[model samples]
Target: MNTNKKAMMSAPNTDQNILKEENNNRIIHKKTDTLVYALGGLGEIGKNMYCFEHENEILIVDAGVHFPEENLLGVDYVIPDFGYLVKNNHKRKILVITHGHEDHIGGIPFLLKSVDIEAIYAPRFAVALINKKLEERRMLRGVKIIEINEGSRIKMEHFTVGFFNTVHSIPDSLGLLITTPNGRVVETGDFKFDLTPVGTNADYQIMAYIGQIGVTLLMSDSTNSGVEDFSISEKKVANAILEITKKATGRLIVATFASNVHRVQQILESAVASGRKVIVFGRSMENVVQIGRKLGNIKIGEEHFITADQLSHTPANKVCIVCTGSQGEPLAALSRIASGTHRFIKLIPGDTVVFSSSPIPGNGQSVNQVVNKLFKAGANVLTKSILNNLHTTGHASQEEQKLMLQLIKPKYFMPVHGEYKMLVQHRDTAIETGVAPENIFTCANGDVLLMRDEKVYQSSMRIPADDIYVDGNDISGVSTAVLKDRKILSDNGLVSVIISIDSRESKILCKPVIVSRGFVFIKDSQSLLKEAELIVYNALKERMKTRTTFSEIKNTIRSTLEPFLYNKTHRNPIVIPVILNSKAAMLQMQQQRALKNSNHKAASE
Candidate 1:
């Protein structure tokens, strides 16, 4: 018997497995032995994707991407492996997005292409952003995107999901409350407790009500678990920035993440209040502003925005530019200006460049390099460092995390969205807040937690949580060899040798041409290149008249040239030997072979 057939026969029909009747009407309920797993966003800060399953149905939350780590040489971003989602795509119905940040929605484009999704549910702002992404990929028509808001509830066949507002760096963020037959699980998307945020704050009353009803399980953000105090308010950051721009004598340039719409709003507010014209740069920042304004997430007057032509006409004192590169990304707008490469914006004396964001881990050196450039260009650089309260984090600190844990007071707690150490610290904080040691489970990506009849425990079955890289535009073509070659080029540079060879006789028909890029100077290293050409010529002579394959000839050249180049330069360059069978050379060899065959035929006759 086939294993699939046997498994199908044993599989339970969850649609009719569990149900209840209230007031003579049947409610869609199912007996859910739940399996909760994280394909990404565990044991790290970004790439947050989670799966909730009951029997044959699964609901996905927060498809995101991770920023490249230190060792991932040329990778732009890392997305979830998606193997689990692909395997269980039939079981998946809806994918719920928490917000519009790239980490939360970056992988949506890939997920839409990889799996069979029924629809995607997100807030209006997130919908607008995801629509922009899909439009870029020309995938808008094939996707079903549903715009949801607070107080909205989606009842699936097996579970019911409710969304409530949560304050974060961006607007339209929501926390999910999922109800199943066994228990209720609340997932608070990345958040902080800001009594007075720029937009909407967390619904304390609703959270308290959920706590009163007794939540069975709770998953909370652990990004700021290691911090001891509460995060500074976004309102405070706005106030400080407003004052900073008000005192600018010349041009004021504020750098921040484009996705932080609230921060951009504040920057605009400051620019307006300071009576300065706002000129936005960077393609990413321009797109965010365009979408935010259209979606009503950001409101700014048209007169406040000026173009490059208008910028030159305005007084320097009345100019304010909001750009990218707060994290010191090389190609971002602010970095270009700092390096004197920007076309429109040029840094001059008395210009104040404010970094309105914090540097992500592993990006401090890059940020420092940008700052050094800004100083060298005679601009005054301002950052959270050496400044009092310029930027604030969006994640909850230890005190705020405790408050959330105390307010929810769930029977079981699992920390999401942080490194391993941060997750452990969150678990300890939960224990201090009266959660049971066994109930507070700390798991990494792909670790499965099973819940049945109000009991949750670690299960042996796990999902695939390996991550894939998105290098440039193509995702699948970036294999290990591609990355290895990239690292070799970046580290040691490359050298190429082009040789015209006689294919029939396996002999060199001309002098070898040696070209080097980022390896050695041709004019200064002429002697070295001459030596390399001679070495390659000798190797080809060794294989002359033999049935030498291209691989053997190339390897022989590599074996002879690698040591010579290394001994001369004390550096290893990637040697590439190109054996071009020239048209003339191959034609001559063919003619010789034909003549030999004709002479043999004549002798036989």
Candidate 2:
């Protein structure tokens, strides 16, 4: 039956215009049902993965990765696990990428290493961007590249796919229209209805035609669904930035996302218009600008785009430096400049620093730290607080979402790209707009929604979705436990206890070493550290007679030491208990271990 179904699905469809009508008959007319699965972009935004199955062929959309939160220290990037795709790769046909945003394309390099995709369809700019990335990995050799323009149609047996222009920070962003045997689903990739966008805001006429053709489901971006009003256009921000650069006393340094070409263009144009020499800072920022300029998405005079050294020679007041590290990433140019760590440039009192990008969620503290450093260095800082109107979001707001919903008028609505609250709010918004509650589907990561004959049924399928942490060239998956640990360390301080325990019996061999971070300092509370060590030592002794496993000894030390130390020090630190197992002949070695633990704990505290 499976073989027969595969043969039938492998048969190509000749009718492209009447594809939807033919799809309805072929999809619903099947003996078996079809399932829709989410490989990414379910609970949290980014790493968007979705699959639609018809008979035997499956089409996957948007394999991407999310950026690591603030506490993921030393992590380079994150990607989704492709276990589901690998297990079912025989049925998977093509990966339809929506845009070139990090969240949408960041995982491609990592994903391709695992699952061999048949083909990839993306817009021109995204294709160029992705090809550069794949080439860097040496994975672009045999890959089939299909450049899809707005209104272009792709046929794969029972499914007919179409692309519509989407307005985002990147050029050539597109929305996907997957017309299956049963119905049509319009996946609105990250976009905003910017009437004055640098490029096109989603092709409405094509959507109107799709609406006439009839859409059963509309899986839309819900990142800003709960946000009120329309997204402010990039053109508006350019004028705002231009206004700020005109009155700058010292060098005007603007920090933003490297991938935000729209924002970069605005900053560059603002500088050029203000008669300021523009110097691009940061290696990553320079790379992006070079690519965008080559593709004609951005333009700057050869005289205008200069190096930091060139800017130093030019009058500081006549230079506008566009750089990276808007999130206050430690090694970013802005962060280094603020810290007085950069060799070429240091922010002076009269200098103007503009944070053109807003702080992403979880990066508030880091952003504030950078702002504080700039302020402390006597630089005149202009952040979101003062330069509130200096930047605008690329995501579509409530009004735009409502307009989109009103346009497509799908039978079923699935809200993608947000947390549970955002999804529920979006669902309710659709409900208020007359979309039936039954028609709105709010799903999480690893959920499978089956649509049969225009009716949707859902089941749970655990798709391996996780973060890939990279430092330098080394890449590894970060466990959930590591993220949790980071959250705890950032929120509360870390308290480490190094102890020398008996080889056979888990007894306190010496004064327990205690170290604490994000907690009370040893200089201020010397007595507190002494007390914490005693607490840890007593707990280790208490567990020595009862515990056998390493984990038990560690847990007992934590539970017993945490409360006692917290009560005494008035601060809670992450308690790490280390047990040193050794031989009786190694008394000096044991003492050294005990002494090392003691010193480590003292330093940590």
Candidate 3:
């Protein structure tokens, strides 16, 4: 949606208006059944937000954000439109978090600013991360975050929510089982079936018991559904990391996701096993490590750690650095080190850099650039490839997806978190596991599903699910038009033409001056620029003859110069016409002259 539409929908109204709208929604939604829809994370990966509504109570699952793509210039991230939640603010609203991953909790701060949430229920790790975020934004006041574990159960007015342990890359990960008046709904938050996990084992007993009880609908993660086999266990990756660390003859530097606490733990264990002192780099890495230690998730001792000042005194072969930037983000710690710009660390000969995480889907080129830089700097680089088994995904593959489906045995299956093709593949897997094709609903972001009397139905009505671009701190400032203009400016550049005119007599005061930036070389293209100036001068002269306004004069110049420049250079740069009022300039000059004369006379007297 455009910026105007976003502002109109999201702008805060008067108290009376808000109360009136809330009252109207309360009356309108009294007969509404169990409605399910997603604000984000359906057609794409990352930002995941799902809504479950029954009567006046709403249970929100995972307020997250999606990182911007390459084309989204100047945008930091994208969040789901909160129009629906804002409109139903009078209802009993509760947010439930699944994990501590950025995609699952990055949008919590923004969501809290938009909606007045009653309370947030999350696991201990996720709660710590959320509090950190809220504190950073100075929004920790008046917000309640209740910590819940596998055995915890929350009873609201319309739903009963419970958690089950799931095996992911991070510790304290969970899947949710929400019970409504209509039936039971299970949300498998980013999971895999790893028999030997690093943190916790998947609770198959609870999953099977829930299946035995019967679920009306199931929303499962579909990130890796296209892969044929099951995902590799984190334990296998830990062993691989240990092997690599033991074989290295020089200093070791490993890069991975900061939120992957299990992987970080393995890295530290490997460091201790190899008798190497550890140094953690990157702010996010430090925060996660500190939190993990405080929570007893990481068991590394303080004696194994060293500061940057001690790196030079310590032997090169005995130092291990764990950092962020496995995805090759330019500002990340590993990227700075690869570019030879890091303040404390520099790449030296015999230094082995291991990317302990796979490159995210759109970051292959960036990772390749970093690898090339490291190779040129006389450092050895190893990544996740067929020859090396340094990384394992946290998502479930096709077989594991089938296992989840068989265990849940949902009456209606809806795939939640992946791209379109991945969702379709998950639907096929569901079909293979005895779920009817008609019972599986592969929906887009805004499509709604209603469960009435234990039967799910697709609704014709929809809610606002458009992406709200976040540019810096302002939410509605960046629009599609703004992005289009930015693209044009980046591609074609800019040109400005300045002219002075006496508005009273409609007379031209001087020749038009032309300036170009990224459009053309002014010195080399003097002849072409001269022609363009002549065109602007003539257009203004002709337009002024008809008592034209400033806008008309500018339009005349643009219309006359654009085609001429295009025909000459075959480029369509943004052409701007600047007008100077000579009448005002003359009046200011007269005033200055009068003041000078009076001052001179007073000095002579």
Candidate 4:
């Protein structure tokens, strides 16, 4: 049997004998058991995608993208490989979005282009965000996005899905309760137990009700599992912002994540309370404010907004600027203003800049750099600290995780949406909540779990779950080879050897010219460059002695020069051999020489 055909046929309706035979011979087997696996978000922080399949129906939770680190070179976002979803596209597929955050819905456009999703179910806020993204990509047509809420319940062919409100940094976040044939599984998107939250509170009653009924498995967020105690309330951050605004005598600038709608709301309200007009900066911030207002999440009046051109007339003490770059991104609005490069806004004396968010895992150095620059420009900077509670995380801490475990009372547990250490910590927390150690599973991406007869077990089957890098508009263009080449160019630079050759006669037309960039200075390394040029000339000459093809000649030049250069400089720069046909060059030279001869004859006459 063909592997692809066998894999596709490994659905629910296959014969028992065939399944047994395939199970013995193949890595993947067809069974009626409920299948649980992750295409991403198992051992890492971002690119979250989880799947639950039973019979002919498949339920997907959260298609997200991971922002590449500084070392990923030119990659924008890292999405999950959609090979499994596309291969099993014959099944009825439904995608349920947890929230509007980029880590949850950023990969929706990419997912839509790869697989055939029956429909997408999201909350009101996420619907707006997704529609805006799709519209920008011109992919809004034929895409079905239905709005759901905490009270909404969806009944599919093999599952019944329900949602309950959960408090997070963003509004309209929900936890999902999916009932499959084997048992009920709960997925807490991203939540914390905030008593005095900025927006709606978590639905504890619904959570307890679901727990009372019974939960076979629970997959929860482990982002803050390592943090001690409960997470701080958003209302507290609001009060801190209010206090800062009341005391500041100059212009106030607040930097935060654009997706933190509640923070933006508090900033707007604080500005209004302090009798300050608001000026929003950054494209992402502007878009979020617009969407938040359109959805009634933000309730500021139109009169509160003032453009940059009006800044000259406005008093510094009466103006408030809200922008992005809480993470200290180089191109963000706040960073530009801090560096004195912004066209409309610059750091003035006595300006109070508040960082309304903490630095993400790998952004501490960048945030410090930006803060240093801001302070040097005669401005005061405030970040999240014990003295000033300016920012609060949306993830639940250890105590909150314990509370969730006690409430859900799941028989089996798997921690999701965090690193490996965090997941292990969450597992220990679950153990303390009376869950058996054997019932807990800490897995990596592509690992499979099967639940049959209310018993869960690990399966030997694995799927394709590799990181698919997105570069610009192309999804599949950035391969490992491309990234390797980019790293080499960034580290060692590039060296190009251009040679003009007469292909018809298999003869060299001119000496090879070597150009170096980021490698070594040509004027200072004259002897080295001359040696490299001679090496290329000799390789080309020797290869052309036997009517060698252009490809062989180029390969010979590259192979000879690479080892020679590396041995000489201890650097392995990208070696590029440019083989130019001498036909055009020879013709141009002849024309120039003839024109010069004609000019001399005319001068003599």
Which structure among the candidates has the greatest lDDT? Answer: 4
| Cα error of candidate 1 at position 22, Å | 42
- Clashes counted in candidate 4 amount to 0
TM-score of candidate 3 to 2 decimals: 0.91
Better model by TM-score: candidate 2 vs candidate 4: 4
Tens digit per residue, CA lDDT, model 4, 479-560: 9999999999999999999998886688898999999999998889999999999988987888888787767987898799
Our model 3 lands, by Cα RMSD against the true structure, at 9.0
lDDT of 2 by residue, 302-378 (tens): 87877756766888888888888899888899999889998788777788998888888888898899999999988
Give the alpha carbon lDDT tens digit for every residue of 14-103 in model 3: 432232233223212227478899999998998899999998899999999999998998899899988889899999999999998988
Task: Please list all clashing residue pairs in model 1, or write none if there are none.
Answer: none
Best by TM-score: 4
TM-score of each: 0.87, 0.77, 0.91, 0.92
Name the regions of candidate 2 deviating beyond 4 angstroms. Answer: 1-31, 71-78, 376-378, 384-388, 460-476, 480-605
| Candidate 4 segments exceeding 4 Å error | 1-30, 584-605
lDDT of 4 at 490: 94
lDDT for model 3, please: 0.90
Q: Once model 3 is optimally superposed onto the true structure by TM-score, how far is the C-alpha of residue 427 displaced, in angstroms?
A: 0.3
User: Global CA lDDT of candidate 2, please?
Assistant: 0.78
lDDT of 1: 0.87
